[model samples]
Target: MKERHTSLLMFGLIASIALFFMLNLVLGSVEIPVRAVIRVLLGEEENTIWRNIILKSRLPQSLTAIMAGAGLAVSGLMMQTVFRNPLAGPSVLGISSGASLGVAFVILLSGSIGGVALSQLGFIGEVTLTLSAIAGSLLIMILIAYVSQKVRGNVSLLIMGVMIGYIATAIIGVLKFFSAEEDIRAYVIWGLGSFARVSGGQTTVFVVIMLVVLPFSFLLTKTLNLLLLGDSYARNLGLNIKRARLLVISCAGILVAIVTAYCGPIVFLGLAVPHICRGLFHTSNHAVLLPASLCAGASLALLCNLIARMPGFEGALPVNSVTALVGAPVVMWVLFNKRKSER
Candidate 1:
């Protein structure tokens, strides 16, 4: 019965994801008929404009949102499980800040030297931004991993992550201060976060990276489940606590880095989705929660993308705003009720 219920829930979530994904294709800046979207996807659409919009824009954006949301949410679940803290996340740990700092250098420094708009640099711009994010995030991730090895206390490690994020932000602020207005505006737009920013080619690369990394994360399911039993117990069970911690953190950090590089610092999906999955399935098992978080994350992101691009808005709203807006209330409601039940 329990397994049956879980299967039903998973099916429901997948159905919702599919529905939202289709809606995203159909209801963009210019609403196309659902049938037209189907025809375009099937290579039968006669209108090049509709075909282009569906193929080149909405499709890529939806795919980006799917991967970004799933990756971040799963990373968040791993962090919360490893750190044993409900609040620890990619942004909270300064990893996203590091990526942002890296992008800031590319945008601010490049603009300070060359007058060309970073956004207008096309494919070259995407590579530059991605490389910058990878460098910045990996630097912070290495620091955090080193600190994890040294710091005996999880709280201390958590605090160190927050401090690193602040340091990254401080550096970015300095870069922005001396940068040109146009560069600053570009950086600001990037910071606001948009799934639509990624081109079809970029989206393919992003999806490929995510596909490789996500499977590795799932293979760590045993390690994650073991860690929940406390360090001593897990160690007694022959788990190398330090190695496991470092491995999980590195994987999670890489996931965050990639998503932040491509999608911007997507805030709450990572932090909130784990909690939502846990509540829905009523399971602490990584085996279940990991996949559940992935599905829930993808569904929420597609929904957010849809709302951001809804008719009246004409996709004017930033994706970060919608995710944060929707995520914050959902988390608050769950936490509040959880505390109430605990009392």
Candidate 2:
């Protein structure tokens, strides 16, 4: 019965993901016909402009949203499970804040601190941004893993992670104040987050990186299952707790860094989707939960991307804004339903 229920839920989520994905492709600023989109996708179309719009713009953006949503959702599930905290997430671990700080260093301090203006750097400037974000996030994740080894208590480690995030944010604020308005504005948009920023060659690279790393997380399912039985029992079962924690965190951090590097710091989907999956599937099993969260996150992101670009909003809405507006309600619904079930 449990397996049957999980299968049904997974099928539903898969269908929703497909629906939202199609909606995103068909409902952008220029509403391309579904038939045209299908034809364009299959290389059976002659309309160059429509084909270009679908392939160059909307398709890449949709693909980006899918990867961003799936990667962050998986990262959040890892953080929450590792910390055993309901509220723990990718940002809670200081990963995204670290990425922001890295970006701040590049954008705000490019001329003054680095003695190299970003604009003059050209293509190298973009490379610098991605590298900086990855380096900063990796450094923080390494610190957290080290702290996890020494802290003993999950809550203490969690608290330390939060403190680390705050410190990173404070640093960024000071940089923003001293920086020029243009740089600050750029940073602000990056912080607002968007699925439309990545494209073409960059999109291929981004999606490939996610595809490679995401599967590695699934391999840890047996290990993760062991973890749910508590530390003592997991230890008894021959789980190398510290190594497992470090590996899991490293995976989560990389996912966040890559997504944030391209899409900015998208909010809520990561933190919310895992909870929603749990509520829907009624199981803690990583085998089912991970795939369900991936699908749910993808569906939610595509839905948000579609809404953000809707004609009513004139496509002016930020992905972050849409995610928060749409996601918060879903999160609340999940919590309320969970509580009601418990009651």
Candidate 3:
């Protein structure tokens, strides 16, 4: 009976993702008809204007939301399980902050030091921002990976990651203070987060990177389940605790890094999606929780994306804002239910 229920829930999540994705394409600010959206997606639409909007804008945004959501959700689940803390998340490791710091240097320092604001450079600016974010995140990930090997304790490693985040944030703050007003404004906008940021060929690359990396997470599911059993127990059961920790952390870090690089530190989805999945499925088993988080993340992201771009808003709302509005309540419900159960 439980297996059947789980299967049904998974199916529903996939269906929701599909529905929300279609809604995103069809119900944007321009109000493209459902039929027209479908025709455009099928390469049958003859209207070049609608074709450009659908093909060049909405399609990439929808795909980015799906991939980014799935990647972050899975990363959060891994971090929570590895650290054995429900509050643990992708940002806890400071990978997102590292990406932010990189962007800060580009957007905040460029005008002050180089006498030219990269933010106004258009395509070149966007490309530079993306690359800098990737470089910064990978650098931090490498540092964390090194620390993981030496620390031998998840608590200590987690603390170090937090400290790294603080340091990065401090640097960003200093840069912001010295930056020009226009540069600061640009940085703030990037920090607000947007799915529409990754458009055109960049979206394709982001999707491909996620497709290649996300499956590697599933490979660690068994390792994650074993880690959940506690280190001593898992070790006695033939698991190499240290190696497994490194693998899980590396996987989670990479996901957070890439997602933050492209989407600009999207909040709440990573921290909330795993908990939502656990509450729905009522299981600690990663086997179910991992896939559940993936689909649920994608679905929720699509829903958030849809809401952000709804008619009245004209897509002015940041993706992060919608995610917090949606995610906070879900998290509150999870906590409330947990507390009641304890009672």
User: Which candidate number has the best lDDT?
Assistant: 3
Candidate with the greatest TM-score versus the true structure: 3
Q: lDDT tens digits, residues 222-335, model 3?
A: 899999999999999999988998899899999998999999999989999999998888899999999999999999999999999888887689999999999999988987
What would the TM-scores of all predictions be? Answer: 0.96, 0.95, 0.97
lDDT of 1 at 223: 100
For every candidate in turn, the CA RMSD to the true structure comes to 1.6, 1.6, 1.3
Query: What TM value does model 1 have?
Result: 0.96
Off by over 4 Å in 2: 113-123
Off by over 4 Å in 1: 114-117, 336-343
lDDT of 1 at 2: 88
Instruction: State the TM-score for model 3.
Output: 0.97
Candidate 2 Cα RMSD (Å): 1.6
Residue runs of model 3 more than 4 Å from their true location after superposition = 338-343
Candidate 2 per-residue C-alpha lDDT over 1-343 given as tens digits, one digit per residue, 9 for 90 to 100: 9889889999999999899989888986688899998999999999999999999999999999999999999889988898888798888989999898888888889866776667456567777777888878878888888898888878888899999999999999998888877788777877898888786888899899999988988988988888888789999999999888878888888899889888888989889999999999888999988898889988999999998989878658998989889988988898899899998
**Model 3, residue 318: C-alpha shift (Å):** 1.4
